[model samples]
Target chain A: MPPEPDNIPDAGQAEEIAELVAKTPDTLPLKRPATPVFVPATLPDEPVEAPENGAALENPPVERPISVPQAESVPSQAVSVVAPVAPEPVSPPAVEFSPPPHQTFRASLTLELRCATPDASIRYALGAADVGEDGTLYDPAAKILLTQSTGIAARAWVNGESGPLALAHFEISQPQWEKKEPLDQSDATPHEISDQRALEGPWKLAAASVRGKLHAHRGGWREDAFAHDLAPAADGTYAIVVVSDGAGSAPLSRVGSNLLCRETLAHLRDALTQSAPLSTDAQELRERDLPLLRVVLVEAARHALQKLNEEAAKRARPLSDFASTLLILVRREWNGQQLCAALQAGDGAIALWNDDNTLTLLGMADHGENSGETRFITTVGMEAELPSRVRFSIRPNLHAVAAMTDGVADDYFPEATRLNQLFGAVLPLVENGDAPGAALLRWIQYEKKGSSDDRALTLCWRDDAAPQPETVTEETSDGHA
Target chain B: MTSQLISWKVRDLMTFPFLSQLGITFALSAAAMSDIPPPETAATEVAAPENSSSDGGAPELDASMRRLPVYLVLDCSGSMTGEPIEAVRQGMKTLLSELKSDPQALETVWMSVITFDSGANQVMPLTELLMVKEPSFEARGTTALGAALRLLLDQINQEVRKTTSTQKGDWKPLIFLMTDGEPTDQWEDAADAVKAARVGNFIACAAGSQANEATLKRMTDVVVRLNDLQPDALKQFFKWVSASVATTSMNIAKSDAPVGLPALPPEIVIVP
Candidate 1:
């Protein structure tokens, strides 16, 4: 006799499979090739009642007519009608019967499980770009108009050691207007661009050391290991480190990131070392030259991505398949004092770790809350449109800083909270004997794992150990969970 | 009894609420109360937002906004032989360049030039810096520095009046009386005019070796010893002037109101 039909509510595919197995009885003589296994026609027409344990089941079924397929075999259909056995245990019952010796038994099992996997990570190394040497990075993709008048180059690493990439050349074009009288503005120069003023004393120029790493996105485990140290000059000069990440989606992001770090260092050094008196004030410098530092850096990154794309395209690849972000750290020590500055653009975060367990954000992270989206500087153009770039400043009084891409930062933390976490993780290192950059890297890999995109960091520190001032005692809720 | 009553009246003025509203300090009230008077200490101790008292101390303007009165006295005289004439022309260019380096110089300095060859001629009238174009420097005959000096005194008076006309703050005017040779005309009257005005106002100085030291002695004792006629010295002098002007201007800018008198270098002598 055939076994009695057991009731099974429809859930999702998992539930349907479970129900089908439970409904099948072991009393009937099993058929050889065509066994009577129930093929669920659409999900059951009834709402799936919650399981006894209250675990979520399949979606509630919408009201609809149930259409069950009739059995092909008359014998099987008759057996079901003829057989009337006690209902199977409501809890779980297992029934097994040996298949006919002459018939071969075939079976298949299917189960479903849901798990969130980490994303792909892109680590950066270093790269550089020469303005006007190649095509001008003035197009929207480059987001800057660089000219020969303002000669500047930038370098940085994208993800880990893949780069020391070269960005496109960036420059500031000369003004159409010229001054006839020493400072008199000629009609050619139509308007004053910005307030002309120089930064005053109490504002310091110095260097700091920062360290950090990037967490891997699943299998693409990359490491961002870099270091920066600042030494004081008797002449009150400085050495700095500035890094820019290429769009992770770019083909040569690693190269771009590294290139940016090196080029920025080299350019700033060359510019300052030429013994050119820093236009004693900010106003003097602005008038004598263009405030193209920010734009130049962006353009350089874009250019690097472009060249890498071109090279990759020759090999049949999409540009920006591995682009990264950008960061800058500058240090100068003078008169027994240190002055430093750090800037970041894209998904990276910069933190200052102090001796008294204080942390500050040197760069900001982009949160999708404002517009439900986050944007980054990228090498690739969508329909020929480039992404935006950002700039920030830091100075001598800076204790220590860390710059890193999102890959190492926990996405669970809101932008503000993540920044706090970044500061928290790196602050102790700067305070401790640990090198700022190195400590930050370790924290990103070990402390902040299973996070977001690619990561990169750079740090600068003072050589002399002047006592740090007392830290502010105000408690802040700005830390990461 | 009368003096005591006067003191009480002065105290009332000091305590009056109206002074504070106008951003003014009542010195009488504070002076009466304090046993010791504060010396003119480096201007650093003075409150930044408030103006320093003019008694015994030069008006303390915010260092960033001080204006300068620069009287460009040119020697359109016979002794301005070929090289000196060319040097003077080139010197103006250098001054422009040096001044431009300092952003504050543009706003702080009011430039005027007096040419004295056969007679004193006002080549350029005192004008607000933001409005006037650079004046052309011309050269010609005999040195009539005395006449030029007279004109300078009159112009200084007019400028002081114009500055006070607005009830705005004032800065000491600087007269850079330059000459290539001795005065060919009688200068006693002009010298007396400068000396009289010099009592509590204006910095009158002579600029060349050919300048009559005796004649200048009658005008204020301030004399710029330009021992070197080289173009470089001229450049250095102008640079110093520019820096001084800028320093004062910066101080002036720090306050809401301008200072009444800018501090001057005690009779600056441009050494070779």
Candidate 2:
């Protein structure tokens, strides 16, 4: 007589197979092709209710167990059925069953699990699997097949750390099984990736400026100013950039700032013409010609001040009404080396980007007795000491240099720390083919915490410079006057 | 006789509150709010929003909104018993009313009121201008200017967040100190402490002929003298204070550099 179909131990057989699959190590050979299991279509469509004893069964089923070798050789679609009889004295009388070979019902299921975080790793009873970079995980025939009444437990490690264990109960009435939605859906995207190639290359100069929100809100004019003149040498070896900011207190500071930019560029042009012969030797330029550069910086300020005074006089306004600040950067090619000199007055800052992607703040803002207060180029004592304020240095692998007014300075150097991290987000885009000035203008305008000042920024870089190894060097300077 | 005289002056000033109100109304109407383009909207032209983030990796726009902390340090001493005290109350009401009407001031200015007599008390903690209520004043004891300064210093340390390595802090505070007599307590030490803190701009106003101008000058470089305590003169002084505060609030929002204050009213002379 054939065994009764109701006595088939489907749950007990599945539990044993699940235990065997859980014990298999990840290093086990994959030579055993994935097996697709088939079970009777009459299995319960919902999770089986726990037995009355509340304890899980541990005894083997009445049917014999399949050996590991035999199990590996089983066809993917083959199904094994075992019936375990309860050893009770009052067992119900078994009903005779007639087996119909041609009418046997069978079904197969394929399960796929996905993690919400793309980087998540999932571990199941049948072993562990990692989600692809695209955040998907699929098992052709989950080594231990799951029937309609089977329960699955999985633990996920998001970003390499384990999270809470997840328990899911399966219910399927068809041959193929799938959940309504993905198991996990991540909301976060990967860190921003830029198409570096799209950015224009071999940039020589970038500049941008914007009116502050406060200024806009109050209907005040943009008093801050910035200007840059990048004059690449005929030999493609040197350049000169000049930037300036007008005083916020001065009624005609915008004009003053514009004049300063023009005058400084003219002065620099004259100095470059005068020192054309000394540019050939790097040592001579650094040692003997450094004084000349300093004098040039002072003369530039004086000329700018004289022009501003003329304008103020024309308007019958006090020269103080046109007060402003100035910054000048000169890069000279000497014997295959780059020498840089910087001059600044009033409130603003300068930064140098090295080949290694590190930024060095050259000079801090010239703050006055208070935080918002600062000395102006046209102030009573500043013109006299302009030359001494010039800072000089010899940078071997300099990639770029940036200058900004107090509006930008307040955001970048709100405190004493020199190189704010916010600027790091900007450095990569300087060389990007996009208009560096326009990019910088947007960056400077980013709403800052306490500052709402007219912002101005100018950047100069060499695209041909080779990238340097990562070596962070902090160069401190007495930024306060 | 002195007490009788004080009572009469107080009654005279209280009878006409419209005068101060009219002055503030005229000042606010004459001034215009600025109309410059905002920086953030302009920034989008260069870099896409997705590519930009603050120093932190989080994709958040930098916020430009900030609070301008203002402190009104008043002298509620015996010298200000009558008309002077009454004028102060009217001045405060007018100031608060005008500021509340100004959208810019309402958005940025945070105010606190500190009154000093035998002791100093913070009648109002730092609060938004729109939310502030005019404080009641009663003049009775000696002027304890030193104690007032000490109290101010403590309040500043507790109230203001100085800029830190990783965080932005409140703007430098604007302090207005109005007094009518010499300090009855030791105030130099407190003044020194205030100077050392260097956290805000302190403008001292010496009211009446008997006010100690020299002491006021020592406390702050920006000092003004009120020639008399007449209601009109006091009203003019308050008008100037309101204009100064309005201009300062507008200036910081518009410019990065420190701006010189608006000219003081003719009746209130700057102490050179």
Candidate 3:
């Protein structure tokens, strides 16, 4: 193999070589032995008969002895093999025997990935290479140094007793950009704080609810409630909506509630990406799948909470100011089944109205005596700590699943009989009607008159024949007390 | 904002792929079987025999060992924008403060930071850590790990090799190479140079949440996986680096000639 384009040393090759050498701490003694470099001129003519192949002896034999002069340039032993000098050498045979100008050495490197368990851990075939032989992996080229190609070939196998069922092959190459620049001495010139708050409708402050009866008063901050519905997609995939109620005690609850919904959406997307597909077999046991899905949801919640903590820490604000209750609903269309999983940690309600008119309360808050009855699962010491368990799972072909903050549950689930009646009326509206979200808003408006809090509800229903809901919806104008 | 959220979602999806990539397999140790070096023990200075074979006839670049040479080969390409770049900047400030806290760094620890944008730039040269102020960096451009590596290797060979005539010191040098993206430029030449210079003199590590570990593994075979591009983690990494260098420099200051330097933590997984 001939030398590749990169291997051909040009005019500045030596300078480049010298710079490579200079990057090191020259204090450490370079143990380059004083042995003379040797380049083999050619093999001596022992007159050995050529084999039948004729391929081995294609080149004429000529030999050059190793002398002190030849050894000085290339001191390394790997490149120092030289043929013994031939005695009374006649004119060297035409350069037929000179070794090819350059021989490219290729080493087949394998990176195998073995998955110990399909759901657990995975290991790389080539764990870590000590290409530099030094304890520290200080060189960026170390990856290239170990593998033959500047690109390292890696293989991954999953579910081999270790973890997960997975296999993959990929190459790792060095960065094409330059190194990082040192920090500027100047103090960070503070920039304008990005107004990242997400809001619905016109008011910077507003409440979303199913009930529309409440109206605004003279000087109070509270006002009428509006219902905003997010329907299912064209592919029978309903959007999972979650409404988090900000703690009224903290001024930032409104902000935290909005952040919770936004962050939960982000987390749900992330979990879905990382989550393996749930086939029909898993869907059969949606009840059993709740535990695992719970862990995922709780983790997502914890992450969002941590982000809030970080924001507070950055601004030197107390953590409590950024606290809010999280209610999350996840729905997907998979394997000809619409799998809906709703999780409520702390104070929230998750209700499912089956197609058969039976209402199952998937989640409910601990409504105690305090005016703010239901409590968020936030403990004094456990900031961002994951809950012991999460409660959620897939529901196959349900009429609809609704998750609402405590404010709605308080006004809506006033009595067990009323709760059953409410489901009886609402499930049919969702099951029989063309527009379930509009129907839900009408029902909630009749049920509650005056409710002032960060109220929200997300209803997701899936049916092959259900009409596709538009992406955006018009906000309703029902006042709440 | 929605686009940002969508992109982040995509990034979240890549975590599995990224985790799979990190499942690297290679020999645990090449030279000898050793236990994980204890934190306290690794922090302590080890002395090599004054006339040990490895230390014999080692050329001293400077008459005085006070000048410490540190070459930072950083990734400042377009890929390392946003938090990654800002974290690096904050990390450098923390490193400077850490050095300032150490008396040895004040006397020694000459620093040079090299940034490879389209190509390698000597953003900062061999200035005394105490004297030189940190420079500003706005990361943007393609990654040229190869060119950057070659540039650092060359600078080390040229500038650090030319030592001062005042004191004969044989301090260990350090090189921290970090990037969050793959090499878009040709890297064969730099890889060859690194292979040639691996004589156990430098400590190189690559870091970044989005770094191409396989590429890093090839370059130095040693990769420290940073869980995030948080400023604190960077500070921790640099602190350890600075401590290791300062400790080694202290040893060199007390020695008459080259001595066996302390080893880095073995838990630091090396790329084979």
Best by lDDT: 2
Model 1: lDDT of residue B250 = 38
TM-score of every candidate's chain A: 0.42, 0.52, 0.44
Task: Provide the DockQ value for model 2.
Answer: 0.03
Q: Per-residue CA lDDT of candidate 3, range B159-202, in tens?
A: 65322212222234566776767787888777767757762245
- Model 1, A32-126: lDDT tens digits are 21321212213222322224432212223322112111111111111011113432222111111111011111111010110011110111111
Q: Least accurate stretch of 10 residues (summed lDDT) in model 2 chain A?
A: A95-104
**Top TM-score: which candidate number?**
2
DockQ, computed on Cα atoms, for candidate 3? 0.01
Query: 2 or 3, which is superior by DockQ?
Result: 2
lDDT of 2 by residue, A35-119 (tens): 3222212332232233344122332232322211111111111111112433232211121111111121122122333333332
lDDT, model 2, position A130 = 18
